[model samples]
Target: MCGIVGYLGKHDTKAILLDGLKELEYRGYDSAGIAVLQAEEFSYFKAVGKLANLEAKTADFTTSGFAAGIGHTRWATHGKPTEINAHPHLGDASYVVHNGIIENYQELKNALISEGAHFLSQTDTEVIVHLFESLLNGGLKPFDAFRETVSRLKGAYAILLVTKQMPETIFFAKHGSPMIVGVNESDEKFFGSSDAALIGKCHRVIYLEDGQLGFVSRTGIHLEDAHAAAVVPHFASLPESKLSAQKEGFRFFMEKEIYEQSEVLSDTLIGRLAEDAILFDELNPSLLEGINEIKLCACGTSYHAALASSYLFERLGKIRTSVEIASELRYKEPLLCTDTLFVVISQSGETADTLETLKMAKAAGLKTLVVCNVDNSSMVREADAAILTRAGIEKGVASTKAFATQMAVLWMFSLYVAQTKDTIDAETLRKQIGLLREVPAVVRVHDDLHERIRRLSKRYLHGHGFFFIGRDIFFPLALEGALKLKEISYLHAEGYPSGEMKHGPIALADPELFTIALMPKNLLYDKTKSNVEELSARDATICAISDVPFEKADDFIPIAAHDHYMLEFFETMVVLQLLSMEIAIRLGNDVDMPRNLAKSVTVE
Candidate 1:
């Protein structure tokens, strides 16, 4: 994934672009660069690692008088993470900053090489600039050349182009990747991959749809479709308040987001409970009327949330439910039964594979609903109905509040579906609602919890990986815990249903292998204890996270015992999140922007 931002205004172009890039730093990047039109010529700088390096490289080029500019924070896709392979890819008289892959770049590159076009970088993005340059040299007008270059390209992209031929305008194109453009109070046009990148800088934003190509000049935004037809622009009010890349008082975004879970969960539940019914006013009940089965699709943390929801859908809704990894489900040619409700979950709502899966389901005439955190994302627009997670901005690449909010939303959806299907009685509905309402208070854990976990983390740095095992819904929580550890700490970890350990996983259990067991007393308590004992018999060191204290554990992290299963889920989740975060912190890892991991999965 890469971050793209641009400016077409009379302000300090370099300063504004750099600020926007910082807003997007949470999106993992390997290299960064910026190109600005200064003194009738393009002045550009590129750096290999981090935005700070790029800033340092361009420190002396402080020209507040630039015409237009574009910057990119690139996560290497078609090239190594090298300075020369970074963005602001140059042509003869233009520069480009791009996100997403160009599938036919190699073929186009071979053709261009045969035509004697010189190439500088080993990135698919470089082909685009060269081709545009070639088209311009062939007597095409600047705008015509831009369109021709895009017409020759294949695969997903959200591109921003700055050319000397049109020094006042920043041309852009969107296919399958996400891009947004907006203007501030000064009539300055701005561009960003996500609205978060332009939140504080812009007054209103226009989300560009696929195949829409246009430019933003001092006049205004000029957008058009592939057939050269003018399309009416849709603008979203720029949201107000704290989406800045501020960790508040915490050391990192992950820690801050973890601490924000209580409020995040409460916000997600607001207006969700009205009288006795679990009301989702946005969704038409007709979609669920004939739904015989539920299919939950997502990737990574969202996948774990979906898997956890699968258990709840079955247990509470009395419905047949299945979880599909979005990436795999796309290639598998999954059966799209019309009677099934297709639910897609994504934090960014722009996860490439998940978006494609949702598209496929729609093509097959299936009713689709998206559970997403970001409003106005691709999936939200594509799906028939959407439920916003209300998690605010999750800048942490490892994801903290996003997962919790997604779980909260899915849990509510399950209850709504249960009531609609007549599978839940009045008493059960009230009890579930009461438990749902109590989530904000239950997740408030032990005061000494973080300090104690910090001390416990020191003992786990050299373990032979970890086995985060649980049962039922906790099995997915186990998966989430392991994912958090491996994504941030670079340690090896695997999650399994505790009972499935002896089938094969238990063989590798040794004194060095650690097991973070989720043995909630409210659900399958005795069975979880039995599984922990089995691992202990094999000398596996145990860090049991439980509401009820367990004497057999090598280390016990006590959580407040709750009568409801979801409350226990929230309590155990806080422990696992803290434990993984503290371990990564002790290992001196960059917990916010984990290595090789991006905040949003914008590319396949």
Candidate 2:
């Protein structure tokens, strides 16, 4: 994955594009660059290894006065993250910044080579620039050149292009990757891979749909279909508050997001409860009748959310449930029937594997529902029905708030299904919904855990081994916590059911290892505590996360004590998120953007 930003305005083009790239650093990159048109020529600067390297190289340049530009921070997909491979990829007449893969680039490149085209970098993006140059040299207009070039291409792409011939305007198109155009009051325009990159700069934004192209200028933005039919843009305010983008004295976005969980969770639950304590109002009545089984398809952290959902669906809805990683679901070829309901979960809604999995289920004529953060991502668009998780912009590559909101939404959805199926008694459903409603307030009590987590970070900073163990619902929480640590912290963390420790994982336990015991105050509390005791006896330093106090633990992180289900299902997860951030920071890692990872996996 890569980050792309473009600007067309009165401000210094270089300054605006560079600032936008900085905002997108959390998308993860090893190289960055910008292309600005000045003095009737393209001026470019690029460097390998972080945006700061490019910034340092361009420190002496006057960024002001340029009218239009495009910038990119790249996560290498087809080539090494080298300075030459970074965008704005320059051609004879046009410069381009791209976000997705060009799957047939090799074939295109071979054809171009036969036509005597010279290549510089080993990137699929370079093929696009050369193709544009070829088309433009053949007398096609800039827009026409882009149109023809895209017509020949296959695979996901969100491209921003600027030409020396059309100095006042920028052209953009989206096929699969996410791109949005933001318009300010003065008619100046901004476009980026995510809305967060353009947040305060523009109050109004138009999300470009797949296969849509637009010409943006200081006067306004004009959108068109692939066939050049004029179209109106649908605008919306940026989902996140302006302040949420600011650190607000916090060192990182991860830390700030961790602290914002209570408010985020509360907002997610707003209007979710009905007079009878049913969770959601948007279920298909027919699907709720005689549901035979439930299948959840998700990837990465969302898979963990699904695992948590499986626990709740079985317990609260009294239904058979299975959680399958989206990438593995097709190969496994698990039985699917008309009576089976499939739930697809994704933070971006554009995750390539998850979307493909959802399509497969929909093709099978199964009832499909999507739980997603983005309003109209591919998965959401393809699903029969969907629930939006209003988690706002999660720019950080290592997810914090999104995971919490996913869990919250899943819990509510489970409760709703339970009510519709008449599996849960009315009073019991009411009590569960009541507890769900109180989660935000309970999360508020432990909001100060960040500092405590930071203090313990050094212990796990160089730790190569980590074990996460929990019982019942906490098992998924444990798995998710370990996944977070491994994702960003680069720790070798494994999550196991507490009861399964003696099965094998305990053999890895030693003084050099760290064990995070998710000992929630639940029915399995004693079993989890015994697992912690077993780790402690093996000379492992135990970090006990629970509402119940433990005597032999090295560290006790207390959560607000609540009913067994709520405690196991909700509060403990928050602490694991904090710990993931703290450990990442201690390792001198960029917790927001882990290396070699992208915020959204748009390419398969």
Identify the leading candidate in terms of lDDT. Answer: 1
Per-residue CA lDDT of model 2 for 1-604, tens digit only, reads: 5788888877777778878888887765789998887656778899998888988988887755547888998888888888778888888778888988899999999999998898889999989889988988889988888889888888889998888878888888888788889887777788888776797788888878888987887567779887888898888887535666777787777777777888998889998877567556565677666567899999989998899879889998888998899888878876788788899999988887788788788889898999999886777668888888888777778787898889889888888888777788888887887778787876663536766776877777765588888887778888898989988888899888999988887888787888898887766778778878888999888888877899988888877667756744566777788788878777788877787887878777
Q: Give the TM-score (vs. native) of candidate 2.
A: 0.92
The all-Cα superposition gives candidate 1 an RMSD in Å to the true structure of 1.1
**Tens digits of per-residue lDDT for model 1, 368-452:** 9999998889999999999999998888898888999999899999999999989999998998998889988877655698788
Q: Give the per-residue Cα lDDT of candidate 2 at 63.
A: 58
Per-candidate local distance difference test? 0.89, 0.82
How many angstroms is residue 441 displaced in model 2 relative to the true structure, after the best TM-score fit? Answer: 2.0
Worst 10 residues of 2 by lDDT: 442-451
Question: What CA RMSD would you report for each candidate?
Answer: 1.1, 2.6
Q: After superposition, how far is residue 577 of candidate 1 from its true place, in Å?
A: 0.8
